[model samples]
Target chain A: MKTRIDQCLERLRKTRRKAFIAYITAGDPGMAETVDSVVQLAGAGADIVELGVPFSDPLADGRVNQDAATRALAAGATWGRLLKCIEQIRRKSPIPLILYSYLNPLISRGFEKTARQATAAGADGFLIVDLPAEEMEPYSRILGRVGLNNICLVTPTSPSARIRKIAGLASGFVYCVSREGVTGMQKQLASSALGLIRRTRRWTRLPIALGFGISTPEQARAAAREADVVVVGSAIVNRFAAAPKTAAGRKAAAQWTARLVRAVKEV
Target chain B: MPRKRIDTEPDAHGHFGPYGGMFVPETLMAPLQDLEREFRAARRDPSFRRDVEYYLREYVGRPTPLYFAERMTRELGGPRIYLKREDLCHTGAHKINNCIGQCLLARRMGKKRVIAETGAGQHGVATATCAALFGMQCVVYMGKVDMERQALNVFRMRSLGAEVVPVTAGQQTLKEAISEAMRDWVTNVRTTHYVLGTAYGAHPYPVMVRTFQSVIGREARRQILKQEGRLPSALVACVGGGSNAIGLFYPFLQDRGVEMIGVEAGGLGIRSGKHAARFADGRVGVLQGTRTWVLQDSEGQIRLTHSVSAGLDYAAVGPEHALLRDLKRADYSHVTDREAVDAFYTLARWEGILGALESVHAVAWLMKNARRWGKKDLILVNLSGRGDKDVQQVSAWSAKHGGPKA
Candidate 1:
């Protein structure tokens, strides 16, 4: 089944421009702010919005994202609450929303039940950061039954065989991690990322979204040229973090994201 | 259907009957698979066997005594007890056995850098020692709190020229240290080997670490039969990540009559909501690459754990131990921090042996249950480490909690 996520990627493919995806913690600052941010970011030109399900131990995250998760978890974010936030965002925006998480949160409750609730609450799908392809067979079946997409990640360190296997089962889009290491802003992207993207390209017809350490618009522009989509996470999460929680603060955060979103689109 | 043997666990995918598997990022999938393949080859490689044997016998000092603890036995007035002195190993603990085994494998894989995660610092010191011996660069991740709790071992690791990266995430203990180490491994997997310290984590690690640590049980089994003309009726060891305990228990798993017990730190007692006792009401969840019994909230978020002994204060049990518990092959019990402190002094005064606070949980349990046994019963305890590294903490604890009464 083609979720809205598949349709959005299909739409982007028709238009020769790159897809710019923005990532933010689901309940950061507050769920209301998160709901508003999704609408605001979507209006500013995010092709898709990824909402991180704040977990206590974020193994794939760097300091910026980790701190953001801690703050969101402290502000009372749970799988159920994050799903409700998604429902709220769905009211105002049709931006394809994906849940970014570690396996514990989804599997911690019950896998099928929690996933059903996520899809029922209007989520397109979720990307469990720590779930390997070896462990995803059952999960893939579950996600498929619910009519939701299971986004797959391709790492720079992923071998050729593993990349093919991961790409084979992937739905919606294939996420290509820009380098080795956790998520954060980095000074330079690894050269291996290009090779990884090229290698992954041979196996899947799905759109490839490049992420990890993509902060600056210049870096976003460079990344956008290589893959079908560009993902900017920690840097975007950081922008709202430094601002106060007032209405003015929220608008300023949107304005800042809009500028970066425009730069990636221009590529 | 034939009853499955305990040793043939995790099958090909590393699942110990729906428990251990490689639950990691894609970046780590290939590295873990490579490690599993190399480990299988190294097991049959005669050169690998020779190097491990040579180092265990000469460098790490193997065949440590299985001593008859006459005074401790008499004090108990019940079981005639014996101690497997893993404390006598070169690094003052049983951790070196696995480190030597893994570091040698790292060299065989042509990886010149190694990374590890430590709590109570024993594994960190052991890894650093091996890195120095093998001429490899070493980096260890430790929780900020653990560095203060196990300061002596931290100093020992630095002295051996390993960089100790302080992890400040979450509760800042063993769990966070492991997460940080995993992140480091994912980033540098091409050049580094993550020497997971215990019989936990992914498929190959649980199986691999248990194999290396099985030396403790092997020696104890051989020594006990020769000394007493029979196998001991029971085996007891401390359970943190369940390495030393599994080390002692694995060799005896086939001996159906020999009872096995694993003691855990009760911390202020399980009722207080401040302990590391997973089996009390454990939830099966994934953490640090393994699916095992974890201490987590209803939402599956890992919870902060506490134990007076830093090493035992972890959120999850080893997957093999989880399977053993499920199979009812072993019994797990807990001892409070106060009892562990009392047991430390009692054992030292009676037997002149000061086990690590982590290992002394076994002694603590034995002391509590001393009246239950008789002289006809034989019990062998794996004293996993010496308490020299714990002296300062012990002194401060005694000063605050009051000195042990005679």
Candidate 2:
């Protein structure tokens, strides 16, 4: 059976439109609101919804995502609660859901067990930020057995040879880090992103998604020009963080995500 | 599977039994691989060894005296205690030994910049000192809380021309500083070398750091033989990231007659959930880059750790220490913060030595357990650093807790 991620990208390919992926930490405001946010993002034209599993040490993340994680943890989001949250979202929406997390949480649950449990909870794939391609083969194989895609990351600093190797192993799509720094919103997208996407095209036929520092609608449209998917994480999460426990904050987050998705779709 | 001997460590992939694997991001893989290769080649080069020796002897003041603490030994009324005076090193800590070695490697690798993370600022000062000596650009990431607690060392690092970046992430402690340092290294891997502070992290780092710090044990082995015509009955050292303890324990691992013990920080007490005792409270998990013992919650989030000494305030211990603990080659224990403070004052009055609070953990262990051993037994403790940097904080703590006076 084709994974939800595979079907989503294939459908987007036929329309000749870039995919709009939205990211939100699973327990940022609260677990119940997390379920609402994923369904709202899908309704707002998000092709794929990424739910960040809060980790204490998010080395590759900047202040926005870091604060979201801190809030999520403060709200008592455990691994089991996060899985249950995904199940709740699965019942409400058909959007492709990916578990975005650092390596420790998944490793603690055992890779095979996490893959099976996540598949059962309606997660289509995983994008572990700190699991390098060198150590990804066993995990990829384990997830593949359960028909789950193991998304891989390619950075601006990645050499061509390394990029080719990562592309070969990547199942769903390649996550292209648009800049040198950690995940955060920037006023403008890095100019080097286009060249990186072009170089990555030479390696794999899989779709490429550009993320990290893509904040504004103008930046989203610019990123959509060179990639198959545009991911807006910090921009949407920042809206929720601004006013954590209010309906107004959730409404702002939905509106902001819709605006970014519209910008990507417009291109 | 039977436990392997101590010599055949960290197979090609850098696993010490089930611990010690590269868990860094993709951007750091190439740099770590490059460092591993360079370290293997440099280990065999006589010129590299000669240069490290020269710096250790002349610049950092090595071959530190192994003086017998006559008064403390008499007070303890059992084991004769000897202090390995790493406190006499140029930067007042054993951290300089590893920094000098890493700086030499960084120079050899043609890297123009070095970055590191420090908890108590001793390692930061050491790295900055070596960077200044080698004429390289240096940046040290320290936690904001630690910077406030160790203001003198912060001033020393800045005075040596190193940029000190205060990390305010995740409780603003050593673990957060390390994460920030790793982020910096990933961003600038081509032109920078991360001079890791302890005998932790991924493959070559644990091995490379252990090799550089082996000088402590080598000298201690020779000195004990020269002074008393035999090796000491036991060796003890504080285990903050296990660098200094491993340095003194590695050479004596083969001697079945010599007992080795590593003391961890017991902040308030282990039951208080406010301590840095990894073996006592931590389980097997990954942190930084290596899979070692870490204090983590049931959901696998790294736990908040506490210790009076900033240097010992970390959630994980080195992978080698984990292996040693499993193999029963060395025993591990913890000393409470109050006991360590008392030992700090005792060393000051008895030997005119104001020991770093981190090192006082080891001294505290010796003071408590020495009476159990025979009167003829001899014990050696690694005095990791001087207490001048910790004086202000200790005095403030003393004023509140009625500890030692200034």
Local accuracy of candidate 1 as per-residue lDDT tens digits, B270-320: 998788999985789998888998999998888888898998999899998
DockQ metric for all predictions = 0.83, 0.62
Query: What is candidate 1's CAPRI-style docking category based on DockQ?
Result: high
Best by TM-score: 1
Q: Against the true structure, what is model 1's DockQ?
A: 0.83
Provide the fnat value for model 2, as a fraction from 0 to 1: 0.54
Which lDDT tens digits does candidate 2 get at residues A171-213?
8899898977788888778887999999999999999999999
Best by DockQ: 1
Candidate 2 per-residue lDDT over residues B1-406, each given as its tens digit: 8544566278876888888888877767767888999999998999999999999999999899999999998888998899999999999999999999999999999999999999999999999999999999999999999999999999999999999999998889999999899888876788899999899997789988999999999999999999988888999999989999999999998887789999999999999999999999989988888889999988889999999999999999999999988988899999998999998999999999999999999999999999877878889999999999999988888888886786
Once superposed on the true structure, which residue ranges of model 1 sit more than 4 Å away at CA? B1-4, B403-406
DockQ of 2: 0.62
Q: Estimated TM-score per prediction?
A: 0.98, 0.95
